[model samples]
Target: MIFPTPEEYTVLVLSLKVGLLCVVISLPFAVLLGWVLARKNFRGKLILDGLCHLPLVLPPVVVGYLLLLLLGRRGFLGQILNDWFGLQIAFTWRGAVLAAAVVGFPLMLRAVRLAIESVDPRLERAARTLGANPLRAFFSITLRLAAPGVLVGSLLAFARSLGEFGATITFVSNIAGETRTLPLAIFTYINQPDGEAAAARLVLLSIILSLGALIASEAIARKMKT
Candidate 1:
């Protein structure tokens, strides 16, 4: 294995863990936000839309720094979380997850929103006419129709999280077995004089993983269509 060293393995595992955690944390919120943005017209909708897309527009380092400020021990929400629940998001694995989620969330949300918007509102109305409640109609009609988009969004988010570097490194640092992920590992390898081989291995791994995810997403989308 290219990652013959225990440190490399630790970094690999931590990276995967952070990526998975980011996906799980962002999935539900992405769906809800996507549905709302696609279907509902509310006051301040544009503001909410802009906020959701802010991370995409901002630099990753800036986002990480903002996260550090907002979730630091002395920060407002951070202090409440620490005092009430003893949760710390600074320089930790959880912090890495937060960083990844913040960056990946916009992609997921955008995908899901497009999917929801493509769904015909008439279908929802028909379900409601059959005595289904709004929530029930959404699950039965809107969700089913938007499954492909959701899958695509999830895959995109997962891939994005897996490759996250700047925000993760800035927010959590490149601590082995904690915040070190694939991109961070690659960067570490590249920093060394004789680290080319290791970096190449990780780079190839990232490409392969991304390709596999794209293939899998297409397969799932096709199956849903059939």
Candidate 2:
């Protein structure tokens, strides 16, 4: 109602956009990584798993800096992207999505991996014996069985992305319309002398969002069980 101002609304929408984009961009990769970790045995698997989780252990600021180095215009990959594709990530909404994906991916991957591992390999084998291909068997048996975990993982990732601040701010800066998100906006409001009310509103919105996600995840899990 009389809560967030227009600027705050813009930040909220931007945060949701970044969060959704992060989820969409990372879901396929997260599912693949999850399946790999859950089912595959390969050399350096531990290293790969650790690398996927490095963002979780490292400081958000450090993660942000790393993204900046890798995706900044002057960085190697960034330079190539700019020169070859005319794409830019630094200081843009896309950069915010990238930061959110980097941080949220581990949670999604872990959940999906656990879910995939929980599925019965025998069922997949049975599907294969019934003339199904590997991909078909996986989708019909393994992925169907793991739907609950996938939903949980996605919700967790969404929640994490919604709250992302340090990495996003570092990689994308705090541009008002382009990159500012709810957490960044809250931080900005807190910095101003008369911004306590707005900051409080944003904090409340964050809590509501987190709670809603949890509730929705539980509902999805229940629906999948049925």
Candidate 3:
């Protein structure tokens, strides 16, 4: 296939950038949450699990709205952040990253939790009995054992972020250079006169990217199982 046009190329790159940033920012926290959910039997565990998976079942638009209420210019945290740190997140690429992260987080978190659960706890305990600290055993044993799931989760999150539309558009307003990811660009094209051709091209791109990411994820999962 011919390369995408300069404008289409920009949107493509932006989608990747936003998706990767989302995963990078959220992965650490997702890993921690996944480990906690998998290993711990604490009070409120049910509530915590529900909250971790909330985005998976909630409407994407509602998630975006909730984010806006927390991070908008006049929002409570938003006002504090702006006044104290001069940091602005809403309506920027940073906000796009935040939107993608929130929407994609549950997928990553679930993948991690399942991966950790599949590991035999005895492996980590053996390491602990051999003089490894809990943290060391986790890093050397449980974490390594769960690497495949973490990889799959990362790819899945990347795919989800690439296709993210409702939350991203609702939060960031699709400014061309700053926040117009592939999905936003596709949406713009579909609504314009004689824009179907361009929209079709982007839609094709989206399908290709999604399939590629999932294929890689499946490959990793299969490799890990072997």
Please tell me which predicted candidate would have the highest TM-score against the true structure.
2
**lDDT tens per residue, model 3, 48-113:** 999988988988888888888899999999899999999988899999999999999999999999
| Clash totals, every prediction | 0, 0, 0
* Alpha carbon lDDT of each predicted model: 0.89, 0.92, 0.92
Ranking by lDDT: 2, 3, 1
lDDT of 2 by residue, 64-177 (tens): 999899989998889999999999999999999999999999999999999999998899999999999999999989999999999899999999999998899889999999
Q: Where does model 3 exceed 4 Å of error?
A: none
Q: How far out, in Å, is residue 17 in model 3?
A: 0.6
TM-score of predicted structure 2: 0.97
Would you estimate the TM-scores of all the predictions? 0.95, 0.97, 0.96
**Pairs of residues clashing in candidate 2:** none
Q: Report the alpha-carbon TM-score of model 3 versus the true structure.
A: 0.96
lDDT of 1 by residue, 98-197 (tens): 9999999999999999999999999999999999999999999999899999999998888898889888888888887778888998998999999999
lDDT of 2: 0.92
What lDDT does candidate 1 reach at residue 211? 88
Candidate 1 stretches with Cα past 4 Å from truth are 1-5
Position 129, candidate 2: lDDT: 92
